[model samples]
Target chain A: MSASLRKFIITRILLTIPMVLILITLVFIIMRILPGDPIRSQLGPRVTEAQADVLRERLGLNRPLIVQYGDFLVEMITFDFGNALTQGERPIKDELAEKLPATIELSIPAVIFMAVLGVWSGAYAAKNRKKPVDYIFRLLSIAVYSIPIFVMGLLFQILFSVRLPVFPLAGRMDTVMLVSFDSPTNFYVIDAIITGNWPALGSALAHLALPAFTLGLALTGVFVRLTRVNMIEMLQSDFITAGRARGIPERRLVYKHALRNTFIPILTLIGLQFAALMAGAVLTETTFSWPGIGRYLVERIELRDYTAVQSTIGVFAMFVAGISLIMDILYAFIDPRIRY
Target chain B: MNDTSPLVQIRDLSVTYKTRLGDTSAVDKVSFDIRHGEILGLVGESGCGKSTLGKALLRMIMPPGRISAGQILFNGEDILTFDDKRLRDYRGRQASMIFQDPMTSLNPVQTVEQHLVEAIQVHEAQTQTPDATGRIKTLLERLGIMQSRLASYPHQLSGGMRQRVMIGLGLVLNAGLIIADEATTSLDVIVEAKLVDQLREIRDEFGVSILAITHNIALVAEMADRVAVMYAGNLVELGEVSRIFDRPLHPYTQGLLASVPTTEINERKELYKMPGEPPNLARPPSGCRFHPRCPAAMSICSRHRPGLNEAAPGHWVHCWLYQDHPEKEEKTLKVAA
Candidate 1:
């Protein structure tokens, strides 16, 4: 690599430091300012007001606001998230370490599905532009993009699980199989495969199918439209016309020349969409009752678990910033016009 | 030179654009020939259908623009009858096209080496050319491009270099003919002149014919052996470059020549401007397409469209002024002398 490119990457990395800091500080403040007392919400009517006060004092909620804010920021830097108020005071870090991988496992496959299907259908639509095939693909993309994620998830469950019985309805694995399978990665599918647990793998994948599809299908529309519109524009470009004039076959012109040029914009969209998918996973996890960070976040938020919420939001912000940085580096590699 | 058979013959060709508003006649009943190993310059103002005519020769007209009527004969075979496969083979091997803007004519993501190699490999899949790299090196060298620039992307190259690469792409298949549709229009004056000189060298070295299309008459004078002037989708005059420049028969041609400033005449003569804009092709003027703009317009010019008449030994003009009239013939002879 050239010195300039290395410098560009280092600059981008340095820039992310301030971005992450701002994001963590904002989430910290937002969690604290929101109305609701964690002890009251967790204990509900079962605990008396005096007992709740005692609990709040023990949890450092009785401290001055500045002191609590400082403590929160310091704990974040050290990756310590204290404990969940509702889950028997289980350490938030341990819950996240166990659940984050499950979210990733589902998201990774959904993204793969979204990228592959979206790009393929998009290219097909562009090549057949102005024809019936193009119209059908375009309408289908619009339909998928407009549908609500949870609604789509529920629909899939009804069709594929309850009525057809082709797949399981909810959760990460069957109850009987869950006990026998040793989770090495906390990601049931990966752990199942690593331990030679084919039955567990089958069960985990069966349960994963509907929700992943729901998430993947919801995001596929954007990629399809992005690729198709960009591809059509690329096909009309002087280079593509020149390629055709050179007697390069139509397929090669569309795929090799037009598609390659269209990728930079598509890649930018994918990066933005990946961040969106991470957020959308919250609703998807809730619908399927899958044990992932998004579902865990919802549970913590309902119980006003401020520490857990702050940490989760911080982790999400970091993921988004990191992905965007990697995308910038990739842009430089793919298109030579971009430089430091 | 006159004895050589024409390589491509266009007979009464017409290309029309079927827009929703109306059908616009871009190339109306045009006829000409590009003979073997000769450069035929097609010169006209913008939107005069010169580029459409060039594209018509290769049957490369896309939607909204179609060759509504015409026959393009290549070696006695009408290319209009060719299928997709035959047209594909004919395009890069028999003839190819170079566009105007070199900056946008090349894929920004592809290197020059890849562009040239793809052009070659697309046509000759089972080639026995053992040294493909060497072949590309020679091709680039012939176009005055450096070997090191082969790995560079289009954005990395200068405009002149990119145009040279475009020229290299045109000649990579050893095509017999190249249609340069305003290829040098986007270059600076010096770069344009250099490219024209290189085109002349390529013609002589490779023995390939060219159809150089442009609105720049000066460019045609420098690069073309023969020139055809088009106005409002009509071929106004066709002749040897010297005759067309010296003794233009059509009034529109005369007007075009007068409008150009020449350094030879040191007396600062006012540049003559053609009085009217080009007629819209959707509803062109009656009789002669140039009649409304013709300086020497007459009643006959508006009533009858004159066919091409041979006024001098290899010079053809479509004008009523050249028709057989004793007095008019004497007047034309005096003008020619």
Candidate 2:
């Protein structure tokens, strides 16, 4: 890389450090401010006030709020997020390992689906602007976007799962297979394939289908609309007109030439959407009873498991921040015009 | 000079557009022929419809715009009659165009070689097998582009070089007639002159013809063999370059010539620029459209439109001064007034 590019990357990384800290601090503060006692939620109604106070002291929850926050920050820097409150014995990292992958598996397909279908439909709409195809796509996108994710999730489950037994609903996999593998990675699909458990892999995907489709449909609609609008505007740019005048094939003109230029802003939208999905997949996960982080957050929040909630929020926040950074770097690489 | 028919013979062509506002005439009864190995200059102001005329010849007019009436006869066949398949074959094969802006004309994601190769592959599919890499390098070199620059995008190249690349794409197709629509207008004056010179070299060396559309009179004076001046979508004057410049007779043509700023005015005045803007084509003035702006406007001009008649040897002008018998003699005397 040139000196300028190196300087740019360095600058971006440095800037992101404070942004990450600020995010973590905010998550910590917000979770603390909400009325919830991690000790009481852990001990349950059987515990006396004395037992609750002892548990609070043991967990360092009795310290002043600023001191507790400072300690939490120091621990987080070393990647030690202490222990889970409700379970008492389990590490927060272990809980995250179980829940994070499930959420990711569910969300990844939806994201990929949104990107491919959204970009394609958007490009088509742009190419056929003001025509019937453009109008139909526009209407479809708006219709899909107008529906809330939870409503769409419920609707898809009703129509596809309950009404018709065409798909298996809920759970990561069926109980029938004695499919246990050496955990090379935490992801079940990868582990299943590694252990030569085809049935297990098939079952996993089967269970994944409804949630992916529902979640994907909801987000893809918005993506398609956003991308289509952006691509349509870009199509009218002078460069596109010039390409047409040069006798470029219509397909190449729309896809390779026009769409690629539309990517910078579109990718940014996709990144922010992925961040939102990490937190916002609650409705989809709950509807499907999928064991994902989004559903886990809702369950913990309802029971008022403050430690689990804070740690989970912190982890999710970090994931989003990390993805956004990667996207920023990618943007700089793809279009040199977008230097920091 | 060797025996070969003219490359393009645009016959009594007219074009109209159905805009949201109303129907507007873009090209009206304009007729001209471009011969082989000669550069024909189409000159006029921005709204004079020179670019529209160029697009009409190519049959590339988009929707809301249509050829209301015209015959663009390329090699004795009217292009307007061609269906989609035949038109596709004709475009980029027999004739191609280089647009004004080089930046937007190119697709950003694609490499330079990919852009040129696609154009070549499309039109030259029937002939020799496409050696994509070889042809691209050869064409780029012919247009004076460096070999290293082949991998660079349009944004990477200078404006002048990008136009050259655009020109190179046209050349790769071996097109007979190249319509360069204000092709050099976006470049610096020096670069514009250089590119035009390079274009002249290409025409001379390759036996290709060019329809160079521009608003700059000096460019036409330097580069064109024959010049046609358009006013409000109508061909007001057509002649050899020397005849049109030395003895311009049409009032609009006269006004356009006088408008060119020259230091030789000797502090006489700022310049003899014609007063008034181009008339609105949607509701253009009656009779001659130039009458409102014509310094020598007469009552006859506003009542009856003049026809282009050969006022001098091989020169055509649509002005009342060149119309009729004894009145022509009387008008010539009155012209001095």
Candidate 3:
């Protein structure tokens, strides 16, 4: 495996840890939310010592094997793990607050950029099928799709960062820019725009362009190939011909009619690919050295801080779930053939 | 610019599909004319190229399929020579086509209103005018669709409603020629009958020429003013709908009528089922394409193709059974004897 991809699987593991933790939490919630609330009643203030010991001894007997997990979901929420990233007694929230936003600031545009460009080029390729432009696009999509993500990131870093010197080589921003940057919410770009800090926005965006594009470009070929295949199928459909017969322009028939018809399947793929990218960001983050949750979770694991680890995983679960839920809702909106 | 010359005259038109193996002649040298304000039913079995002939009139044949030879004259102008811009104006303005399978014909994502308005916008120059909206609502209502259904997508509508929506799209631009190509085959019998009435209503109200193409003889009988029967890309018989249906001259047409299961006790005797599958267009029979399946096949049927002979007033048949023909072959008479 490529070094960057090896780390990506590791990051995927990091994201998946949250999923496993969430499953455990779901069991806890199910136990807690049970019709009679048996566990809560068992640990009430007046319980006898014998009963307590019996309950403790069984380790949740009468429970399925799957339900015997620890419950520190509350502690994970409070988040008081100290000195994980820094020298002495610094709160883990402080580290997370800074790193998580950097990852997100880089990710949002990457996903949007890749999806738009991918669909546009894919539709273009389908339109020009068997032509020189179509062949070139098909070739480029395959080439781009097969190359590993980290390798492309490194190559781009060498070209854009080292040789060309147009962007920052590593980190979210320059030391000079970082010193003056104030981010309470920790989302640098959003914070910059809201504050009307044009220079800070420029600095953040300038630093962002390379890694975001590299991250986006890596996954773009997948969208292109998918959209092209579906668009070609849709273009031949009766409605497309119907549109043509109605004197609807060929351009509208393609981009508006045929493209929208392909969206139901493509939206599903987008939802899946988005979740995959969000959870599988370890390598891209490592190559660009953007301090995100993947690195933090690794450090917490090294220190054997179970509370920090579980909580971070819980948060990651929510982010991925939130994105997928939004996508599915968007699916209902895009395709009238189905309801939520 | 001849008003009396027929709204559209298709002369020697042929559409050939270029497959990897060879060219398949889908519509071969078929000549016909659709006059103003008439529902001309084109009936044939599957693969007879009736649909290809309909698409050919509008120059709507896609790639791999080309109009190899012929002229489609609309208002005495050759549509085959029209450029892209002219073709666009010609379509949906001069002519439009309603398709088979309404389930797959209307864009699922667009509402009925959007479908109608955009179809008009292609020629109307303005977008979303109250004038267009009012016309669409009125037309949909006239087609028996409720005003509320106008906002609904195709999937929300029944098969019959969707077909009506398709008709609305074709009519919104007021095209001179409307090709209903197997337009109601996917619907149920009741829905098909209802749509047939609506089609006749459309012709009566708009006075626009319609070329109704279908394989269902009963449907063509109900809806068309005149019927043209095709067999293996050949026009075998054509006349007034009653004349053609009552006394079909060609053997293929007779077989087609004879095969239809009727409910009348007297007409419920042994049905004539056609013996063979449709001939492969890439390698058709030497003389008559239908000769192998033709129950009344003769030596001349396998040796020399028959030309059309008018058997009765306004009734034509392409068959060797009819004597008076203009063929130059001298040996056909001896063989017939």
Candidate 4:
């Protein structure tokens, strides 16, 4: 509401535009520098130089670096990413359309799992600080945080999918469907329910549960530690004391005074963690063979699909920047002090 | 003024903090009564347990700083025996506290109206008061904040304004006894003077007993009706304001008085500083805590501690200098008063 806050929001929004462009440009340049030729790789090792050159020319790779970059930038501005060299006439948008939903399906559920479990654990640990429960949660967080996500994903795959055999090993759904549905919202859960496929909806949730939980386990420690540290510090603040002095209920003080103050920092951390989650999804997606962007990027990278690699990374970077910007704007709403 | 029942009766109250090294006494057997409608000044040096005593009275000591032993009777009911819920119920309804840091004492994320409304709702939840919002707005206006500030956050206010908001928060609860622990220590002198004057006026208007805790003797002199001086962890002296300034009897009280520079001097003069740092509470001196730096220390002063005893009709002193020594009893106690 203040003039300074208005100026600050405008400045933050303006600053984000250049940041997005620079990050995308950097990803674009770095992809070119990495050792690989998309056209040559697509032609395979047995192809002749003549064939590779023809393919390269056809794909616009024969142009000068600046001209190629300029053309790509212009195309990107129009939101019409050209066909993938490897896919041979398949547009990048089509690949994204198939892959983005799967990635969101995995990541969004994982984030929700992390937020609920992690925040509760953190709050509990802070409330029972110095006790056995606190120590146990602290050690659990440390162990979870120390283990590599890929290793944990493999372990979960072995235990939950292969050994126990309670859930599907890989893929979004089974072949023989008791009920069929159109992908209206691109999310199976919503689309199945919309099309009146109750069994399909149930199956979809069951399929999502394991991978989501696995990834959630990987992420929970981060939120736990972040919220724990912030909440502990917030508990000592004079505002909490004032709340107590005002005779506000202990539960109210804990929720209102303590947790709310910790939100700004927690929000900033959550935004950073979401970006990390996108990067980490490559491993989870590949391990599970879930056909998400992570696996798409990995498979493309193996075949040296440079344009696909660069564009995918660029899109993810843009997503990260956009979400963070939105969060920074929301920061003003969460904490009035952040308006400026 | 004729009410003889002490609003707050603290007896043999002692607080100790359990540090990693050892237990340190923050308030040692410091006891005093706050009479109704009277402003009692709890004055001492920075580490002299004035704030500790005030907090102990409210049963608000934080972790590790436990009230080792005490009886703080508010309205003849000992508050230390109350459970958490009961204590909370009694906290703002019967007593409330205003902290030194107004900026931090308020939730910066909340609006002024939200803060006041919370306090009002906490204490007056059962009251059928349709004028609650109006009353809050009027209180803020009286505290010099405009109607627009009701919707403003703590960060939006100036330091003086934040302090006024904190004061308004303490009073809005309508507690019988208000403990202001160095409430104006964070403000400019002029603002502090204005606020304290405003606080005194509010006190007079509402007939609320106030425990005004500050290290500034001058501020205490201006606002408090009676003064209690603490040293280390002891309540060394208590008397009427006039007696405290005009006839301080205790050696520690005299040292505190000497340390303060006279404002009337106008020209800059070398102020008398306390001779040494306060003794460690974990291992205080054998005789008197002030004996190490006391210029008037005698052989007996190093061997035996003194007790708080009546030196005059209303003045109390805690030093061996006014002891019943046949050689100097009459003259020493008489001259000091």
In the order shown, the candidates' Cα RMSDs to the true structure are 2.5, 2.7, 9.7, 3.0
Which digits, one per residue and each the tens of the lDDT, describe model 2 over residues B1-337?
3336677888788888887668888887888788998898999998888999998887878878888886888888899999876777777777888888887787766667777877777666653445767877877777889999988877888999888888887788788888899999999999999998999999988778999999999899999888999999989998999998887877777778877877675667655666788887887788878889876767777777778788887688877767863323343322211
lDDT of 4 by residue, B113-223 (tens): 888888888667764444677888777766677888888899888778888887787777667898898999999888888888888887887778999999989999999
Model 3 misplaced stretches (Cα beyond 4 Å): A1-71, A77-89, A298-307, B1-3, B323-337
Rank by DockQ (best first): 1, 4, 3, 2
User: Candidate 3, chain A: TM-score?
Assistant: 0.75
Per-residue lDDT tens digits for candidate 4, residues A263-338, read 8877887788888788778878877777889999988877677667767776787778777877787887898776
**Candidate 3 at A279: error in angstroms?**
4.5
Candidate 2's C-alpha runs over 4 A off are A1-10, A44-47, A178-184, A336-340, B1-4, B125-130, B265-270, B295-299, B325-337
Error of 4 at B249 (Å): 1.1
Cα lDDT of model 1 by residue, A1-340, tens digit: 8898788889988898788889878877777778876887877878887999899987888899889878877877788877766668889889888999999989999999999999889998999999999999999999999999999999999999989999999999999988777886798887887888898989999988988999999999999999999999999999888888888899999888888888898889888997889878998999999899999998888888888888888888778888888888888778878877
TM-score of 1: 0.96
Two-way lDDT contest, 1 vs 3, winner: 1
lDDT of each: 0.87, 0.79, 0.79, 0.81
Worst 10 residues of 4 chain A by lDDT: A173-182
Per-residue error for A166 in candidate 1, Å, reads 1.2
- What lDDT does candidate 2 reach at residue A198? 87
Q: Which model is ahead, 2 or 3, in terms of lDDT?
A: 2
TM-score of 4: 0.92
